[model samples]
Target: MAKYKIKINPKNLPVFDKYWHYQKSVQSPDIDVKFFRKAYKEIFDKHAVLLREDFCGTFKLCCEWVKLRERHEAIGLDLDPEPLAYGKENYYPKLNSKEKDRLVTSEQNVLTAKLKKPSDVTVAVNFSYFIFKERQVLKEYFQNVYDNLGDQGLFLLDIFGGSDIFDLPEEETEFEDENFSYYWDQEDYNPILNHGLFHIHFKRKGEKKRKNVFNYDWRVWSIAEVRDILTEVGFAETRCYWEGTDKDGEGDGEFKPSEKGEAHCESFVAYVAGIKK
Candidate 1:
């Protein structure tokens, strides 16, 4: 019998697109939009139509929001042009003509942008507001949101913390099916200031690890502090949604409004809703 060998083509291999990988590993925009809509309805007993996404890096949630309802509209505000452009190139094309018409993006600072219309709901997720380390600055941003919302509007924000988050220097998640791994690196943390430096790294199969693809310098604000600030910013009411644990003692991804949260959780994620009356 003759010996035979198989040949491989470079074009057949998957291209390394960092944004694609980041979305797959970090974001669940489809679910997030549903949560936002549900939370709004639960509080106000009416459907929300317009949403504003702040620090919306690619605005994936905005795209998902419009897809949820024919009447829905979304405006994404971000200071960085790079991600905004990427979203236009990649995510925008996926929408139909009508859906495309309902979505908008602006390369402007969330703090200073003049919104022409009031939003039914506004969101700052992924702890993006943590970039505002100062209490007064964050309050100013919250006040901006409060002012931009329509009557009975809602503002939602996601926050994360736990004992393990501070102690863990780095954590890696492998996507075996995708042939890549994602890393969350905690480079430094200041106890006195409550400031932390974090980075996201990715490694494709058979490739060397890429470091610091995304960097975040943040002040880790507690849930109580965030609620207090929301109250200070003139939100009529503030609510907390705590994540439930699964049978395996891991986060189950279901967040329900709760007055008290688990005190001894090693790592946890939750949302804060500020409502304007």
Candidate 2:
């Protein structure tokens, strides 16, 4: 056997930033803030000033919310310190003084944290609430949200489902311009319990793929079940906003309040708003 040595260049090495990659692939906080404002206005015929983000990993949405308007204020609550610290270091410095004054992040659990003032709008997006695998636990969390909201508050949640959600195969998406790829890997699913294990992987150009950069152990809850739980938690009314499809049958990213949803699609994403009167 011939002996061989490989030369490694530090300058050429890629910086594998999991949070940066996750933000690129998963989050659209700017657009989401606008949507939240529009949805709140449409439902209540008034602009919302305060937003509470639950399970707010990295709290990017809270930072964006304050920047959306002069009067807007936001609070982000999450139990995890790692993402909170990331937000403080990466996203916090980008905000203006006024925006910084309006935005706050707390290391607190959504199920038990107490808010000094009730929020006009609260969101648990990115399906973060799916972490609660049991129906009772989910309901308890919803009740907590209900209790933390103002008299005319709105609770918004994003959900995804379809025929192919269960037993979903690992899917890879390439960002050619960014020179990286993102992978959604579904490790396992239990149909009876609707519980699933999922992971996110990333691969930089000319580098080996990074496995399990992020992982999720969640119970897939249906829109109907979520609505029922909201009702049980004392929300006066619940509404579904279904996404519109493009000419090619892909999601067009325009969501509208819909009485009915397309059921035959292999995958779908929608929002459910719970109104507290």
lDDT of each: 0.91, 0.91
lDDT of 2 at 63: 94
Residue-by-residue lDDT tens digits, candidate 1, 1-277: 1212223469775456778888988999999999999999989999999999999988899999999999999999999887887788778889999999999998888888778899999999889999999999999899999999999899999999988766856999999998899999998888899999999999999999999999999999999999999999899999999998889988899999999887788888899999998
Model 2 lDDT, full chain set: 0.91
lDDT of 1 at 88: 82
Off by over 4 Å in 1: 1-15
lDDT of 2 by residue, 7-88 (tens): 3468875356678899999999999999999999998999999999999988999999999999999999999887888888
What's model 1's overall lDDT? 0.91
- TM-score of model 1 vs. true structure: 0.94
